[model samples]
Target: MAAQGDNRPIGVFDSGIGGLTVARSIATSLPHESIYYVGDTKRCPYGVRSESEVRSFVLQAGRWLAAHDIKIMIIACNTATAAGLKIAQQMLPVPVIGVIAPGARAAINSTRTRKVGVLATPLTVRTGAYTRAIRDLDAGVSVYGCPAPSFVEIVENELATGAHLQERWLQDGDVFDTPENREEVARTLGPILEPGIGIDTVVLGCTHFPLLVNPIRHALGEGVRVVSSAEETTRELTDILVRREQLAEDDVVPEHRFATTSDNIAEFAAAGSFIFGQPLKSIEHISLDELDRY
Candidate 1:
């Protein structure tokens, strides 16, 4: 029989399709491991929800993932991580990994000037998770947090409409490379990229924010290092698996499954394929109404 630990899949979840970024990274980094991904698309934009509400939603989803016999769980959304990780670590049977600490660690390691900036949803900013994580590593470093809620909408199929974007930023087009587009993005993000902030590294605090890295990096200028938790978090996952001797032993193709709390599984699958550059297998629809029983 196969090693017991290696046979179990890794459970990863986000408020919506954004966590696919994390899933994609995990697949790329560990080709032999199976993944069970859950995206709470029906009640997405978890950024606006109260912490208690988000925590409840997260727990419901966690219980659902646990039923699949996953060996490890990754909380891929910053808002969910802020609201639910502690509770998850306390209650879940498997090791719970979150995006904030990895992202903060990557930023602190990449910064040349001890100055770091974080762009996240307003809810994440309110939690101060990134700020606290960074300071926990190095108390002398300066951390700045900016709420970039619009970026989340832009990534999850909401088109950014403005004369400059002309529906391109939300469309499948590159807007970050062109000078005019960059200028427009800079102008649009002016308030967030405030003056006199000499940060050398920026943490993309929300999982969805990675989709807007180009524009965000351009808006912040060339000098700032843009950091996404996907890669760093994947590295953390790899280390954990190795330390636990849970790494899969073969390169055989692993079964990956997708689940969403949304009624529109077709739309969610389309968006997931677009984000991951691969056709998603049959997506299972999960209902929050039914999940409330657990």
Candidate 2:
């Protein structure tokens, strides 16, 4: 722990359980720290909601993190981050970070052809967060946005993969990241990606897109580097904590605190264990009836 201040836990939140991807990355990148994660699974898809709704939801959930004495607050959903981060930063005292800036920075630094294709949630694409983040680096970088709604849905419902999990949830391929459907999605998305842009890299700006990495790589063809916001976002969080002198001194057998506002927590935990590459240390359910309390 830093000598100057309290080494309270870090808090991570998302519209749904997909933020576990970010949390999982954080576990590896900052093993010494304790983390509290909240999944707003009740309103799982914030992508189509109005900005006001997203902001309010983030405020409610992020405030819960604050109550937990979190030293840092990470908005793990790209859509929520796009709509809520600016306002959340103003309202919160801690160092607030989001996946967009880090992911964008990574793409800008990695792209050889200056043409970057971004795969994110519908709302993130609608808001042009990735485009703005990339353009902030250099206006000439041809940044394209592709909305992968099904990817988020698959994750929200926890239908990722595995024999037991597959039996638990109905197995039907979606609009993206499916073996049968990926090529078609690519064909449709590829046209929007102008060849003149010389796109040689694609940014998986949405955390859920990380699960789609292999399929996306196959669809985008060879040589296109697929960068997930997961690793880059984790690196950013680590740097921010270190810069702020908030990193824990030693690994505390790193505990994962999972809280969800949905009835499907069992499914999420199963999915998260796979993503975290470890079993959950704890799981708490936020009963829908307790909405007003939270």
Candidate 3:
């Protein structure tokens, strides 16, 4: 165990369960570290919100997490990261990491061709964070970022089983797994992947986008590589912890805590189980009104 950060839980937050992708990666990569996750499912889809509003929500969540004595803060939402990361670094006492830089690095490393395509939320696309990050790594890389506003809604709706684990997997098919869903996704992506783009790599720039990876891969074809921020972000988090001597040394299985700013916490718990691939036995409910106090 590192002398300084051996016992504190790491904090992670997203607008909703989509960030579970990152959470799953962290659990797999750094099994010894504990995690406290906050999902603001009630006021979610922060992608459509104004930058100032997104920043405020992120800070509210960060404050709540920090109050619990977390060792570090991970903003797992791409929209929130785009809107609030720099401010979060200044505001929070612990290290604050976001999804864009790691995803950008993954894309930059995976692309054999210099062209990379980004599919993300409207706000994230507007921020151009991924483009800037990729360019920062290698100035000559071509980035084509497209706003896929409906993807988040699709994922949320698909994850909505209304508290029943058995019902979560739709009979027709999971959100993007059906032929109809795949066609719709392909139609949505057509303009983004138009002829002559020649992008050899595509970054799933929004955390929610990973849920639709199958359809996205089908739409973009097998030739292009699809990169999600989860894996690389976990890698970055692990590297930071190790470099700072913050890695937990004990063999004890880490305890995970889940919280949500949602009225229907049962649904959120179901969604967590559905998206996170973990049996979420319980979840604490938090209200936006409470977050407003921070």
lDDT tens digits by residue: candidate 2, 63-176: 778877899899999999999999999997677899999889889988988888888778898899999999999898988888776666655544434325533434553323
User: Model 1, stretches more than 4 Å misplaced?
Assistant: 1-5, 158-172, 175-192
Highest-lDDT candidate? 3
Candidate 3: RMSD over Cα atoms? 1.9
* Residue pairs in collision within model 2: 1-249
Candidate number achieving the greatest TM-score relative to the actual structure: 3
Q: Write the per-residue lDDT of candidate 1 for residues 241-280, one digit (tens) a residue.
A: 8888898767667889999887877677766876665778
Q: Which of 2 and 3 is the better model by TM-score? A: 3
TM-score of each model, in listed order: 0.89, 0.88, 0.94
Q: Residue pairs in steric clash, candidate 1?
A: none
Judge candidate 2 against the unseen true structure and give its global Cα lDDT, from 0 to 1.
0.77
Can you list the residue pairs that collide in candidate 3? 1-249
* Residue-by-residue lDDT tens digits, candidate 3, 63-167: 999998898999999999999999999998889999999999999899998999899999999998998999999999999987888889888887775565446
For model 1 the local lDDT of residue 136 reads 99
